[model samples]
Target: MTAAVFNHEGPWTEEEYLALGETQQRVELFDGSLHVTPAPTPRHQNISGELRAALRAPVREAGLHVLEAVNVRLRPGRIPIPDLVITGPIDFDELNVEAGDVRLVCEIISPSNASTDKVLKMHYYAAAGIEWYLLVEQDSGTMHLYRRRGGHYTEQSVTRPGDLLVLTEPVKATIRPEDLVP
Candidate 1:
């Protein structure tokens, strides 16, 4: 099979960005630019797995789905692969999920992408009309939940390691940040 080759230049169009297909690293499109990020660290993956386990049952009961590191098309020229997402039913053949189908988007923050997750993605998710935003800080074992209010988000709760994060919207689930890591 032949490899796909393209110019490594900026101002990439949506079709051009999608043409890169599945890559070894995470690639996202933002404002006509392609942003490439390395894969998550082991600790990050562990936390993500734990959180997924915690939310699985509850989300399933609500007839929703929880996915990890999937392409979410927020709008034209904007697609991000969130750490975790709670979404409605999706077809198996689809390349990406639309923002409307996504009820919640979670980001496990590491030192490398702290600012991007906390600020940039936060703004984009909110503007996309995704109802819930979850931020998990890998270093501190802290979780922050936000709910969309108009075109922005309002912090609903912040739970630390020892405390339990009780969520009702999108799905009903309780998670303890401390349990996210071994």
Candidate 2:
């Protein structure tokens, strides 16, 4: 694995970011700046795990790849580590997957970084042509599912704990929001 660039002072290029060493804490690049975020809380992991479990079977059956907490390199200076990401076959020895290689990207909104997940990262995902973006809210098990169209992500469904999320765009998976909560 390449070192995660650890600079937040000024804007840095993606090459510069990748050449840097990794940090003990989880780090990500956004708009040429490095942002260090703490490891996921137990609650966050629970939610992420549940969602990953739910999608794994279907994704695999469809011959797609799913991973958690991996880097989606949208472009230079705009690399975001989504909580969960589903994409096509990935090459070995590749440090990061390009956004274009992604079919779907999911983020379990971290309370400390909800805004970035909702706004900045969402914009980056959309611009990169990722077709699906699943936003998981831990506490309520609410999901704001999105699909890219016209260069933006629009809500495909707003599902709650009681509702089943049926997705057909990126893949076919029937998921329950409550099942994703810890």
Candidate 3:
């Protein structure tokens, strides 16, 4: 589905934002424009859960917060609900993300969201100064990791179901490839 380019001038409020959450659909708000994405499949959920479980131990011990599918406000009207996001301390509220609290954000790629996740969201996340971005594609069983550098993502690494994800920032959290594949 495509979202019309609205002539809206005001910022979308919390109520209006939450109202759209009913469909259980995933969409991102960028400068008053909305980009809608399809709901993930069962395999997507399994991989996401696996990623969460792999990191939960280190995250909890380090007092870091790991959240799934929450709106991370990048600017006045730019908010993207990353599939998985980890912060030092997390706020469970719907519209809770500020600018820099998010250390690493991730997305699980499905057929409908491949381009947006790999290109659009990658650029935006780098611009937002989020330290790391992880993209997992369940179809191919591949994970691509990107690290932000000088307002852009400079490091790109690809891993399959047997590799390990080594993160550089926040904490040195690692995830085996098997842990991320459904």
Candidate 4:
């Protein structure tokens, strides 16, 4: 839906936030506040699709679920729709996945969400005890992987265009940055 549907002047309650229902744009709830982001561009979709395809086999082999654009409830009133999530068993009937079940969350950075992805969400994901975070910077053709350490995230690796991103913790998979785009 449109932002007009959320014309209230105060912070939204979790019930109200959920009541807003499926939106055309990406909508998240943080501290009772709503953060609305525009739908991703075609290039962003291409990268997400490609990355998901690359991770699918290995992630599934590890007995994990790799999902796209799914609601992740970090805590009460703190639900974020991550671009990609590698999670443990979750019932398909549930509206969202719990933070405890999630192993990794990935976000493909675009101009509009660079800061949020690189900083804000990083802190949130780490604080919630999620083990890994993957960031794909489309403009630079790079991917940065982070591992959680003591309520914070430490950079695990940075893979550039010509190199392969080899990950083994959550799953064993290798991906090339350039291959993320068409």
Candidate that scores best on TM-score: 4
lDDT per residue, candidate 2, 56-153, as tens digits? 89999889988998777897678878999988888846878988889999988888999989998898899999999999897988999999997899
Q: Which runs in model 2 stand beyond 4 Å of their true positions?
A: 1-10
Off by over 4 Å in 1: 1-6
The TM-score between candidate 1 and the true structure equals 0.94
For each candidate, the alpha-carbon lDDT, in order, equals 0.90, 0.84, 0.77, 0.90
Q: How do the predictions measure up, each by TM-score?
A: 0.94, 0.91, 0.84, 0.96
Candidate 2's error at 95, in angstroms?
Answer: 0.5
In candidate 3 the C-alpha lDDT for residue 74 amounts to: 82
lDDT of 2 at 84: 92
Predictions: Cα RMSD each: 2.1, 2.7, 3.4, 1.2
Give the range where candidate 4 is weakest over 10 consecutive residues by summed lDDT: 1-10
Order by TM-score, highest first: 4, 1, 2, 3
Can you list the residue pairs that collide in candidate 1? none
lDDT of 3 by residue, 25-66 (tens): 676777656677668899998888988887887777777888
Candidate 4, residue 19: Cα displacement in angstroms equals 0.9
